[model samples]
Target: MANYERKIPILDCGHEYTRRVLHGKWKIRILLYIAEGINRPSELERHIPQATRRVLDAQLAELFKHGIIAKTIFDESVKHVEYYLTDLGNSLMPIVAMMGKWGNTHIDKLRKAINTSTALA
Candidate 1:
């Protein structure tokens, strides 16, 4: 069996905290959609058809609570709400992009490694 190696920690808890918020199946996608200006719930649903309405709403709410996203309510005759990434959330865009790049580049290698390890087992 190959031993697992520990990499250098970026910060004591920053990585863990970021992972916690980005842990949801749809969280990163939702953030990207919002960043691209899909603000309303309906728009978000349209963008991510695989995500159910209930799950989308719940995830957005959690993002809001984490200060990653903000909702602006337009109090007009017809009330309208739109979601946007907060500065904090915007800061994560680069990190997310890097993750995407890394995943795209290394997922195949990861799959091969896993398969090899499983075969050995």
Candidate 2:
């Protein structure tokens, strides 16, 4: 058995707060898809086919709670809802772009390491 010691950080730290907002697996992807104009829940689900509606909805709720995204319920007979990024959410786009850029730059090396580890196992 492996010894799993956990260390906790100060929750009030600004950087930690920011990380909490972007903590979920689907949250960042949801933000990017919204930035790309996939504003509806169904559209987001379609764009992120790997995530189920339940998972996406949970992430969306968290994002909405953190004010990173806003859900607008339309006044229609059929009732429509759309998501828009708040200013804070818009502010995350560049960071996301940079993250993607960094991943792209190092993907070959990262993949090689993962493949080697998998083969070793």
Candidate 3:
């Protein structure tokens, strides 16, 4: 009879959820822009000129669905819509900032490692 060993289960990733929210071209930029007081869709588009309107709209929809952002519609004179981070989304700021700082600190080392690995290959 063959003996089987059980491997420990991997922990679920809360950080991964944050990373997932930031995934893709415009998502992070949009979130950061919103945090910096750029709230409207047109303003977000302006901030991220490289992103297509369709893509930006899609990502905004995803953010809205995930409860990361809230959309407010105005009924006054001209139709206006604004996006803002929910309390949940605001709570992720520190984690994202830390990730940015860590990335900045380790980027040089990561680049060197990549270069070495590619050279070996």
Which candidate number would show the highest TM-score if scored against the true structure? 2
Q: What lDDT, from 0 to 1, does candidate 1 have?
A: 0.92
- lDDT, candidates in the order shown: 0.92, 0.90, 0.86
lDDT of 3 by residue, 1-121 (tens): 8896768754569866766777877787788888898998898888888998899999999899889999899988999899999998898778778877998999999899999999999
> After best superposition, candidate 2 residue 91: deviation in angstroms?
1.0
Question: What TM-score would candidate 3 get against the native?
Answer: 0.74
Please report the candidate that would top lDDT against the real structure: 1
Candidate 2 local lDDT, 1-121, one digit each (tens): 9997768655788888888988988888899889888899999888999999999999999999988999899989888789999998999889889989999999999999999999999
Could you tell me every candidate's TM-score relative to the true structure? Answer: 0.77, 0.84, 0.74
Report clashes for each candidate as comma-separated counts.
0, 0, 0
Superior candidate under lDDT, 1 versus 3: 1
- Of 1 and 3, the candidate ahead on TM-score is 1
Say which prediction, candidate 2 or candidate 3, comes out ahead on lDDT.
2
The ten-residue window of minimal lDDT in model 1 covers: 6-15
Pick by TM-score: 2 or 3, better one: 2
